[model samples]
Target: MREATHDPATPLATGLSPAELRLLLSFAYTGAVAGPWPAVLEAAETSLRYQAWGLLTLCLDVFTRGLTPETGLDVLAFAVAYGLAQVGRVAEDYILATFPSVVATPAFLDLPAHLLIRLLRSDGLNVLHELEALEAASRWLMANGNGQEDLAKEVLSSVRFALMSGRELKKVPSVAAGVADPKVLRELMVESLAPMAQLPCRVRSLQEVLVVCGGDKLTANLAARKPSRHLWFAHRYLSAVGLVKRVEWRALGHFPDGPRFRHAVAVVGNILYVLGGKCYYGVRDTLASVYRYQPMDDSWERLASMTCGRSYFAAVALGDFIYALGGSSGEIYCTDTVECYDLTPAFPCPRRCQPLPMALCGHAACALDGTLYVSGGCDEACQCQASLLRYSPGEPAKLLAPMNGQRAGHIMEEAGGQLYVAGGLCQRDGQTGYRDQLAFEVYSPKLDIWVLLSPLPHAHVAGGAAVLGGELLVLGGYSHETYKDTHLIHAYQPGTRRWITRGTLPHAYTDFQACVLTVPPALQWVPPVVSGNPPPPGYMP
Candidate 1:
């Protein structure tokens, strides 16, 4: 196979062939037309290797004043059929600019339903909610395109997209009731909006804090742009502890023009940072951009570029430092490259921290006392890691603790002056007899020993762990198989030394960072208002 040339004659390198060129017509120019009625866009409707629908819609304005009512309707018709977006404001401006009485016609109704349906599947509600005319068009399809499978698909897609809106839709209440069933919403949002497949995977760095205060708070920018994804993971941890008033939906692509940050996440005071994960550079290649989310401003700021461009790496923050631990650049491989940024105000520079002793990706980390602890990561050999290393802020990390057996993809919690490692592959040697490899163990920092705790009522690894009400609450993660498994959340009580299963997470919110946030006792109460609700909100207050 040959690569597509650096030639305008060919836009794609492979996949679609030359014979497909029949889908399009020669480009026509009608911008100068001052005749009776709407003019047609000149860009070809179709071309080999792709659809030129976007460029054509752009021409709708460049050529027609969009004042040409019939021409505007035609472009909208094509856009609705192929699910084209981002052209509405310009196109509408043209429609009013042309200053004609625009009306919907039979051709508009006859357009393929797939585009309208696909539009519904757009991310957040930005595209979908913006499509007032298109949504109305889809409703027409549902009522008129009823018996046809194509029409039914548009109806279903719109319904699915509307439910995904995460905001209440007055028009679709009954449909929302059926689809918004806590059981269903979480399943729809796990995958990203990017038309890509599992670009390897990595969880964000989240600290488990105990907040006795009540109400649910969104984790700053964890899913800042896509609250739907945040809501799916938010419920289990946020509502469990009562730290937010609600999972607000202000997080829809707030950084629409910001640099791309894929497969990455970071947590600072009230800010969430997302770095290079996977952004489409070519059809298959991923982007390497970084973004920062500020919770207070509800905005994302672009940050320093990564020294080494990579995605799918685990990130952890200890003290004023944030670290991108390990992950791959592209291939299904593992890396131990570490890049960290010191947020110290006087003079901050990002440099490589000590690399992991082994290449551990898809791992979890927790900070305790003064040391950064990491555990339960899988390696290149596809082996679970039982090795635990503690990184001192200024000094080198020492391998003070080794788990009882091979463990990976499990949760780690540091509480009450002890390190609790549970729900990983705690392999047993012949010394302990059991056909199964599922169990948990706790490391005593004081006694310098590993003690076996109660086994999970059901086996789980790579789950989420947070210390809430003095118990370790473990949420959604994969079992031995299936990354999409969501069933029960196991709560382990350290005092009673037992495991009690709680409600299942909405879905498998596996392997992502889960934090238990709390306002410190000192920061808990705000000073009352000196002059009717003029309260000072802060630790100083």
Candidate 2:
């Protein structure tokens, strides 16, 4: 028999052998929680230092019926620390809501300040009175936590708001976002009403609304700093829409001039990324530009003067380049030309790429590595296109296998290297025209064939699709009569062949485009190991 250590300070190896440790590692890695794990919980906690997530990780596999006392805190810490952000942040909520011993301070919040703040946020502050003591625990944490930490301030803010209602009903956006006060809100409303007698033609602008809305940093808001044309419309529109209980646009100053952005715009790396099309009139005509919005200063700058100014263009970003595919580029075809913009240098003017294989304008394009796959656009004949084409780097575009049917204005996504096509218009026999498609298709490069997958729950098209943490998210787009108002994000898991609905976006949009910039393979998942366990959970294909 092996002799035990005489010194209590010295590390003591439990009776479990190295072979048993190896077996526990195997169960944790594969999530094969069907059978019993031989080792006790203490052994697993010790391994967390080496595995870096040994405790919580094992718990994630066995969380429900699986959460042993040993693995609970570790799992919560692990999920919070890594920002284990998933679709709907389901994993995060599971950890916070289910953990039995997670209320401990400083150490329990193993996350960075920002993450800790997020974990504690709650909206609607309505909870059952039974859990009041547990809910009030947030106040204790805020008081005990360090003042220097932003998380402490954030938590204190939430506690203040939550205490008023005494509830834990909502998984709010984040505490760092600042909690609101009812008393402050009422005072702000009176102050906003103070300004209502001022501009008439200012009918609708963001400025009027901001001045009256009474946000936390109202003085520093865009309307107060450098007012835009929409500032006027913002106030008037809100009041007219009954959003503002009693407010008028006349309180704000003169509305500003031409073409100001009216949406949540962004500029990643360089390509001027804009969302939610807005119309700004010139002196003579009401012209709407495909506004290339700049995030640096929230400025709206036009790109390429747009051969045709139209919303709902199919946008696909690859490498550092953005290819604006088919939409109404005016004159029948969105010009069949793929407008490629180099986003790195943040070009003042966009440089157009050569036209696509042909003028199948308004098509969907999906990028895999450097090659772009284009499909489903209207052709010169004015018929919806279902022909598929592949565009490789430095190579001319060529047609590949066509979809099983004709679908223009469809949505495209990729999983497991196979392209997934969502709902759109599909015409059979060139007769009975259908506004929306109930079917979907998958294209396999190896097989060089198209296979039909499960049909969509509802009919829609031109929606935005993104693969986040391995789930292919297909969001809102144009439906039959009007642009779909719902963000309607759905996640497609190739493994289970399932489509699960997720949380909606901050604002619903069909005119906008969404491109998920994935961190390269090296950084996204784990680095290559010679031979060991499979990849981490939820890695993109």
Candidate 3:
């Protein structure tokens, strides 16, 4: 028998071996641990079992950073056993994102049935076709379904058979009949033949959700417009009879304060940061207040305010900080001040950064390859700008080749490793007057050139843009030509080089911001209901 510590101050290690106790003590005092793979895992297990939270957290960090295709399934099992929700979520996401490749690994066959079902049930599962999901389920059953008939039925049922084509459906019985009850399989096959419009199963799952926040809409009675504090996100889409499709949008609660528009929004990790914007219609109502929405709790927290009030500005998250660039500061004209918030701090305050060379507003900005790129906005003189500028902290802005034409209130986003600028008011060449720009453009960083693409079917100004599932989406914005807000959503497909209508917002919303988020399960499972209920007459987006 080994002797125990006699000192009262020395904490006793009840469940840990001598090696694990040493590893834990070292991590406790130095915030780091090291050992062979087996010993490290043992330390992690002891840390969690003994409630050494700090050491456990460090272990999780190491595990997450070290995850690979071979070790990902093991991480999921460990996370589930230790109640490490965040780690489990990340591992599951990795597995789904690389499903095709991950499925080939031997570790995948060893995945427990409970975990397999959880992955299949997620809306975030990434698959090019329903057959892929069916294949995965079949493989799992062949490996693990030996005597677990009920479990086999549940796993097979998780695959969305309705989304599979007739040929794909035919293979289901051949693959699943050996494991699941033949009677149950027959009913599923019958159900899949019904018209897709009538079927309840969603056609596909989305890993990234598009969240539209804080835009203005015409109030009831049509007397005046009111800003909306409501936050909405599309969770699923249902297709009806030919050419008719509807989106399932649900509320993710509301923003803090009253309501805001002409503001800026950015997402770092899963946290949403809502920055300065006017709360009301007053020209001078610009806000410096900052708030963040935590999806973990569906809660909002007010962070340190910006140094200057701004609206019609651009915000982008880079590294550990969110940069708030040029916009109007409730002044007679826009301002060129720029600031950033260090997300590392609990109560992060804005830190001053090098200002833009000229005052600009209604512009669009995106961070690409660690550098900031700003394009197409109005200068202080109220003149639309065609210039593109590259900027970095503490350094003067560098001007690049200007766009083919001037624009403002447009959207700029990075997709497929390049930047795309579209939809804003643009000056017609040689004309003193300006019109809504239907023709969009793309910028190539390697060649440093801007090339015009096909024109949009309709124009959008002050619209929100986000990249979801590798597609560039332009959300609700009022048309400069018609001077009316639109609820329609347009997505640009790079493969076809065409713009396709994805769906519409619940309301005609403009001057808002949209970001792609991997919503927490709490918010994702909120029972999606079709919103767009006939707005009491005269409801403008």
C-alpha TM-score for every candidate: 0.45, 0.46, 0.66
lDDT by residue (1-541, candidate 3, tens digit) is 1434444345466645555567766776788777765666777788877888888777788777766566778888988987888998888877775565567678889998888998888766766566678788888888888868788778877887766655666777777757778887777666555554233565455757789998888766767888989888786654333332456687776887989999999899889999999899887798999999987678899998999899999999999999999899976578888999999988898988888999999999999989999998998778999999999887788999999888899999997457999888977677776789877889988889999998777678888898775457888888776778888888776644667677778888889989977766544442212343353222122
**Winner by lDDT between candidate 3 and candidate 1:** 3
What is candidate 1's lDDT per residue for 1-541, written digit by digit as tens?
Answer: 1323344355446543332322232232332322233323323233212555554544544533432344555665544444555455444443332211232333334444553443344322121122242355444554466446544433443432222223323344344233233333333333322223223211111122321101112233544221112412221121122211122111122333422322455567755666555443333443345566554344656677676666546666777887777776667467777888887753444687777777876566777776677776778876667777776655776776677767766667876567887765543465442122356778876666777877777656545566654467676555563333443567666545667654554334443444443222332232332234553332211
Best by TM-score: 3
Candidate order (TM-score):
3, 2, 1
In model 3, the clashing pairs are 508-541
Q: Pick the candidate with the highest lDDT.
A: 3
> What 10-residue stretch in candidate 1 is worst by lDDT?
243-252
Worst 10 residues of 2 by lDDT: 206-215
Task: Using lDDT, rank the candidates from best to worst.
Answer: 3, 1, 2
